[model samples]
Target: MSTPSPNTEQMTSQPAILDQTIGSRLKETVGQHPDRLAVKSTTLRLTYRELDEQSDALAAALQALGIQAGDRVACSLGTSIAHLLVIYACFKSGAILTSLNPSYTSQQVVSALRHVDVRCYIASSDILLPYKAPVSSSTLLKSVFAACDQDDGQVSVSSVIVVSNGAPNEQAIQDSRVWAFEGLLEAHRGRVVEPATKLHQDDTISLQFTSGTTSLPKAVALDHWSILNNANVVSHLWETTCEDVFVCTVPLYHTTGITALVLAAMLHGACLSMPCEAFNAQQMLRAVVEDRCTILHGVPTMFQAFVRLRYSPEFAAHDFSHIRTGFIGAAPIVSSLREKLNQQLNLSGIGNAYGMTETCPAVAVSTRKDPDEQKFYSVGRPIPHATVRIAARDDPHQTLNVGERGEVLVAGMLMKEYWGDPERTAAAITTTVSDDGIKTRWMHTGDEGVLDMQGFLTVTGRIKDIIIRGGENIYPPEVENVLMQCPGIESVAVVGIDDEAYGEVVGAFIVLTIGTVISLIEDTKSDCIDLRQTTGLQTANDASGSVVLTAAKAREWVRTRLSHHLVPKYIFLVDELPTTPTGKIEKHKLRTQGCAALAITGAIASER
Candidate 1:
């Protein structure tokens, strides 16, 4: 069976279709301010006029190659100005641009290409060279080409255009279907301008693949309205202005960095600083100080790295008074780490963000002036133009009362559908009747949360992550939050293991800071603190009359302070916890390891 082409006319019927898509808006903005810099990297900078002209030329070239609207173009290029231009060109031509992870193995890359049904691929020569099937299957990929090298000497294997003059890899560049990027752009320079077409609000803009805890990663299709609305709402909530310069250290592939930092910055005409590499504490500090950046966005791990650098005299010497807001997302931040950031950076806002890729990357974010509790404990209220409510699990039509935790239902600015998967789409969205027999639909978030009387949203847990010990229910995040408060602990994740006596036993995986074990042991040996003190508990351990509790004893101490069911029965100390490609801990993998050791039914159950 052949794939159905996306209907362009249906987009005009949606009420939420904005005045312009990102490309048209950029075109208008470029005509008005031609000389202004639209994007900049360490080695290159392009004015608005240049970027617009280049993108238009590239679009024309793509059309000449028989590429049309609804076509999927796969790009495996790294961060560069030319790559950004390619994205704009794709948007202008009404084609979907899907970015492939550069680090993906051959098998992973082949699988992704097959899943998206890529028509044309732009990457580096090395990437295309020695092209062997990563998997044993028939793949219908068409044209493949290597992108031009940039001034920085960093090679991008999947870029559509190459800018530098280096000898091409003979083996990879031999395909008759392959062509140079510069030639393609030149070929379409004299072509007639393509008029702007009306883009539907529900038109899928991008497909982001996210790994579920149990199953393989799922491709999330975010529509134009969902993405634009999310960016606008988050920009308004944070009071982002045109004059603000944002320093972004997070990778562009991650949703938080892509939507909240890159896309949001472009929407507001704010200057964004994106380093060519991953977040390095010293390099980031240097960028912030030199760029005169007012806004900073990163993950909790990045902030922790920066705080640790503050102890160095050279790092402490740098001034950070220019930073007005420092936003942290992608991971849970402990109280100590938050406090340290506030003290050292003098941050006006130390915020948190919570959302899945299916929710346009950010459903809620804390403002600069919001209280510390709101920024840390809760993920803040739903942004304007978005709605959140708790609904009964079995009855999707029923709404729960305020302050009652239930499944989270998100509506307004939600995705149009999961691409090529109608069954998944139907399962995710449920139909309901509003007042006066009016029918409506809501996207089931599959998360558990509650809304306060003030309308502030508090996410408690994922419905699947809840641990039921005996008859009592336990949320791993709540326990992990408390466990992270331990003086020597750097990071922790709580999971359920099987037990014969109890249906499941809570297990704590902990990673300590450098030399924390020695420090904790010495502190215990000197009688400066008890075992409870080391684990951040108020009560002492009463496990067979041991004064200094080990990892196992600490669990007993927590059980004494809280309910027995809430306590973790086993504790495994490690150097670091395993994380997914997007930075979340692979809890499903951990649960599998735990279940393999024992026999946890819930952990062993097959999940779709």
Candidate 2:
């Protein structure tokens, strides 16, 4: 048995109740809830004791494979028990975990592997064509840990660790590196996994890739302190408690899911439930109702689907009485969607959160008690320990006043640098000296927003997404949110195009709900106009005689709701809008397509 280390002095300046290394804190949770269910899937349910024991065994196995501190281990596994084990093992071994999206094509996978130059891979056997480093040939790789077959007890490469409920791939499982992980667990002596050195608060723990608007992907490095601090901030801000049950259906590779849902659950001892498969609205609703989930964390798109599902009569029959709170982040939510959810689903409140992968995914978040106007207009104030300000690019000393838009600046509880990209790191942070010579620097958020007199931040739009409508400063997301409220519209994307009168005008592409018609015809002439029959016009057009529903109809719907100047001038029907790999609607690409379509139609205004 490993001897327990003596308690060390706490970092008085840092947040309390959270360890710099979550691995240690996780182990403590295991001790507290040894018999409680820690993970559950369709075919698996693991208690905390079993989870801890398995993690120890996996850590030992990794050590045997020559994995050590600072080593980069990449995983492209499914949402299974084994995948979680791999992540925990990496944590225990002090190795940085780089998560790869399983749906990525091989070329993309190759590019990521090359970018990170991973030292080892723990992948699922079912996913053929394992990820490879970009180098022409491998070097310094001790072995491959896979759920396939293992040949003899070879000391090095090409070894697989077959993992299945039933028959195993004996051939792939026989390699030296392909030791049976479960078998190793049976042999373990219940000793704690020991680390060569203690993990520092500043040491990198994980590298998450964020897709840039243009350039290649950036590896967002998050350290132990940043993660722990942000988790504390979010859990405290949302009032997550031990009694809360969080429904986490977003992919674990996504930043929001990892930092917000999974980590927060662990921090607060909240129960977490998510299926092995990707998110399905119907399945999620059923699970939430059955599990009595108290909290839900997801993107805006996911909630829109859930709202539509709730509109069905069949959905009203379920028992959703237990849901109390929900947090939506990583995307903008339309006010119409929020209102619909509140009216239909009984969701307690909707929080609009803003952050990036590098910041542990939370800087600002909304609350339930705020007035409807503030909730609709701005993301709430900065969470604890975060300092937010807006500064002009040309004059950092000139802090913008309330309602004046500028670059968002953040400091405290932020990452110190990006891994292996000093140039980008220097570009991201600014250093200044205080009167006493203490260095003060803040991170440039690359987003533009306005702060109200009360300090609430309203993100007008991304710096790159702003449209200078003859220097009027039009934000497409603000317009898109209004356009999405149109009665017949199912989805919308707004962008700006060049114009002579105005430097740019907003154009929207809309996807209408199925079964909408452009024209409604009636046989009034044959029926002698039936003026007497249609005398009660109020009841005659209950819903059937509504105006023809088209993209133009959608435009008219918004025309009545928003200012004439704010309404989009053109609306086009599209079966689908271009989306980013992470499922966000790609506005720039749609803008290009929209401009081309308008040009062909001769809708472009002549030089006037």
Candidate 3:
């Protein structure tokens, strides 16, 4: 349904929204701040002028390699300065850029590239190892490497360009069809390459694949109007400026890294700095202090990694005083983890943000100006020019009142389409015309949430993740929040386990904190079971190899805080939660694992 026709304030004051494309706007930043540091990695740094000229050289080389406007140029790269250069080159040359994670299996990479019919494939030789493995090693390697990815008619990749990390990769890249990245730059440098003369705001600039937790990932095509403007507006809202050194840990391939960190930095002339090519929690924090980085953004796991190491000898007395503001997102953040980050780290300006990959990743964010309580728990207000509301779970036309739990509906900053999949796109976005003749398209976010009277949005859980226990509905986060309050528990995931008597029951997977002990001192009258008795543990694989806590104590903790039905009937202490390539927890996998672990009989299921 169309949004309750945006009020006059939202309709009239969209001056924050820019009409220009990123390629042209970034050049303006070069002229405005020529000497400012633009992009930085541990080994490399480039000023705005240097970045502009280098991207220009790469743009010429890309066009020389037969890349045309609207052609898909795929880069199997990770978060590196070279990847950042390729981003600008594709933008400047008018080619639609597609980033593939280097760590993915060759089949996964080929499937995504073939889905878009990528015309030019660029990657470092190190990133090509997966594609060049022996025929017996990979299912898709029998055809060829980076060529003939799809069938005869479906494969459109014409050429492959190989980049070097720091040394010669010509020997590593022995393919006859490969072009050296250094050779192309030497030949094309100093050549003038003009931006696409007819670029439109609606033209797709970046094609990205979602993390696909429960199903196959979809390729999302994003336009300049939605992505670039969203970045610009958020930069303005975050008050990022040339003086800011924005240290980041999120992978550049994800939408949050590109739009919120990279594009935002370039648009505002802020220096986008990284600790290193690969993720290291300690190294990332060291960069924040050593480089005096003012802003840092990352997924929950990145922060969780640091929290796990915060008490080490090197990190115990570490200083985060130089850091001013940051963000926690891309996963559900329980209050326990939030409090650990807030109290132990002594970080003051950390806030929360919410959105999906399809929303170009930023719809609502809590700024530093927001109250610490609101910033910690809520995802703050709808971003500038974006409309957010809660609609009845089953009926999109029925808007729920403030504070009522429902599905979240967002109106702006959405992707153009699930590239080439109109049916899926139509299913995701709904269009309706208002009585005044204004047409607005709203995306149906499968997340359950509520907007408070102050306009702050608190995400509850995914609609698909709700557990039906007997006749009562239970949100996993509601139960998980209570479990996090348990003293020895570190992290938790709640899933619905199949039960013959109750249809479904709650099951929990827990990871304990360091040095935690599950004591039965209170149960002195009870006999202790043998250590070899793992059947009662209900474990799938105790990656820790030892269970420190008992299921009874963990279940008792939840039962005291939440409803009896909401208490977990089965609890498994896993070493770690299964996650997507991005940091989102995969609950569907947990459901399968939980089903296998649940050996509960009718007597156990009927327990009080």
The lDDT values for all models are 0.63, 0.65, 0.75
- Strongest candidate by lDDT: 3
lDDT comparison, 1 vs 3, better candidate: 3
Which should have the higher TM-score, number 2 or number 3?
3
- On residues 1-608, what C-alpha lDDT tens digit does candidate 1 reach at each position? 42232121211112233545777667666666677656666766677677778888888877776677777776655445556666777777877776665455555665665577666566543322111222211121222222122343222223233332234533333445566777887877645447356566566667766654435656677766677667766766666766777776765555565677766766666676654533456767677777888878777766766777776876677768777774676655665567777878776475677677777777666777777766667776666666677788888777787767889887766666666778887988887777899766688877888776656677777777777787667888777766666655677788877667877778777676654542233123211222222444322332233233356445544665566677776665555677654456777666766565443333444341
lDDT of 3 by residue, 340-433 (tens): 8778876667778888888988878787777888866787778778888788888887778766889999988898888888888898888878
Clashing pairs in 3: none
Q: Which run of 10 residues does model 2 get worst, by summed lDDT?
A: 523-532
TM agreement with the true structure for every prediction: 0.80, 0.82, 0.88
Q: How far off is model 1, as Cα RMSD?
A: 10.0
Model 1 gets an lDDT of 0.63
Root mean square deviation (Cα) for candidate 2? 10.2
Relative to the unseen true structure, what is the C-alpha lDDT of residue 216 in candidate 3, on a scale of 0 to 100? Answer: 72
The digit string of per-residue lDDT tens for model 2 on 199-289 reads 7767787888876565567788877778777877677766777677777566666667667776777776677676644566777777787
Count of clashes, each model: 11, 11, 0
